[model samples]
Target: MMAVDKGARCLVLNGATLGATGSGVLALFSGGHPLSSAALEGLSATAGMASLCRVLLEQAGWEDGPGRIVAVTGPGSFTGLRATLALAQGLALGYSASLCGVTLGQAYRAREGWSEAYCITRARRDRLFMERPDGTVWAGPSGAIALPARAFVVGNGVSMLDLPQHETLIRADCTSPDPRDIYRAACHADDRPSLQPLYIDAPEARLPSQGLRPSPV
Candidate 1:
């Protein structure tokens, strides 16, 4: 069920980072231009995804043909990461279109003039997920994490850090990665990396007690 033409266009999905209201974002693009973008708020990701699909088919003209599907892989929300990736995978498989995953950090770095910057997002409680200027990732309590001198800091976690006068911080919308940047990052991706979810901490579904339990016959 792949698209007849792989290069016709691409549909980008961004739900890896949940907004304050737990809403997800969806956007469609063709030839580097935005066709449609929407926010799925106060609704289940499943429902939101369905609505997005309808928009792509009806408004974006994907009903007649399929196209590439790209989604954001996260160090953010668990449910969002899983749901968006699953949707992308399913669409790629069904339409036989190329599937790609981009990280929030990558999207941030894709912005022009951004040679180096720190991408940070809120993690469990006081902790945060950070992407260093060197592209390495780290996660820990906010108090213990330190930013490199003179580096730019961005994302939801930026507010948590007390920056020195020498450091520059860009406080922007970290709740959702820009779909255009996600597509740009995908275009520049190397090694054709496998699309997989990025998790920074243990999933909330697992309990601490479960880790100590022994298997029983």
Candidate 2:
């Protein structure tokens, strides 16, 4: 599901870093150009991933250079969510493009062609992070949710079991949301997203029980 957007010259993914439970994946899209994308498996990818994205645009055949880039935010990982979000945020800022986000549920909708879908990912405290077509979120690591009647569900934590919500439910494939989808949905998407990571939820270590605080820079 790729399109030649006069809008974008390159793309990048870090599916492995997000570790979306059963949906861990990493992808990079750069119009076959010298794509400036990042997906570091550990400790973030490139030191200046954003700057690279800008450079990639030139290689992407953009004579004026790609003035924009795109990135995928996440709902958290099997381990946690903080790291990924931080990385995404920084990149978005550097590129000076508007930020667009796609929920895992939206990916299912693309795959299943339904009006409603639940994109579930494993979360801490035995819960799942539920992403919906309307961009609504449910905090359930295991329980299922009703599909939006006209949507499809896809992702790791999602399974089509016959429950009350099952009428609206369908098991979804573990497909991460596409940056293109996010671009379409984002009203703020003026251009490429900065190098900022978007974690849909909090990490267990930062939970009340853990009472841990983020380290200072």
Candidate 3:
């Protein structure tokens, strides 16, 4: 039988952009070892995440005190980010578990073999969220962000970059934050990471109102 850690277990959550053809994954980790992970593809993240949490808890066999919960805080689909953050926050509060938010950039940084890492994730159409090798973050149209020569690029936005040498980029299996990396981020996070979503643009519902209004001549 696997030994239980008594409130030392961790639950990590990650999701891809809505309609992005990737899976939402949740894992149960004890110590540094992953105990069980559950994933569902092509399901509505808003609904799917809640179901995933139950599956993960059952898979891990939680019986006692609450455990830690880690969630990825955007730079991806607005809908996906909202759903994930809400689910994680709810679970944390319900279980009285420690909660932390790991930015998508942080997940990429946790990966090995990339000193000059340029983390990028899809934003709105033709736009992206990019973390430069120097650690500066910017979000704008694809052509707006400049890339240094030979910087190792990763993330879902890489495909949309249309770079000359696409062969040089390090594309991940999935565009979403890797669950393994999310776990690492939770472990090494300073205190608690912010739970705020990293939305680069205001909601479309407010866009029309944001336009400059005509003034009296």
Return the TM-score for each candidate structure: 0.81, 0.54, 0.83
Q: Write the per-residue lDDT of candidate 1 for residues 98-130, one digit (tens) a residue.
A: 777777888878877664768888776788899
- Ranked candidates, highest TM-score first: 3, 1, 2
lDDT of each: 0.71, 0.47, 0.72
Which lDDT tens digits does candidate 3 get at residues 90-190? 88877878888877777777777654568887777788888775556788988777776556778777878775655455555546656788887667885
Error of 3 at 16 (Å): 5.6
Q: Is candidate 1 or candidate 2 better by lDDT?
A: 1
Please list the residue runs of candidate 2 whose C-alpha ends up more than 4 Å from where it truly belongs after superposition. 1-7, 12-17, 20-66, 78-81, 93-98, 107-112, 144-151, 160-168, 178-201, 206-217
Candidate 1 lDDT (Cα, whole model)?
0.71
Off by over 4 Å in 3: 163-174, 206-217
Error of 1 at 162 (Å): 3.5
Query: Which candidate comes out best when scored by TM-score?
Result: 3
Kindly give the number of clashing pairs for every candidate: 4, 41, 0
> lDDT ranking from best to worst?
3, 1, 2
- How high a TM-score does candidate 3 get? 0.83
* After superposition, candidate 1 runs with Cα above 4 Å error: 1-6, 19-23, 163-175, 190-194, 205-217
Give Cα distance to truth, residue 203, candidate 3, Å. 1.8
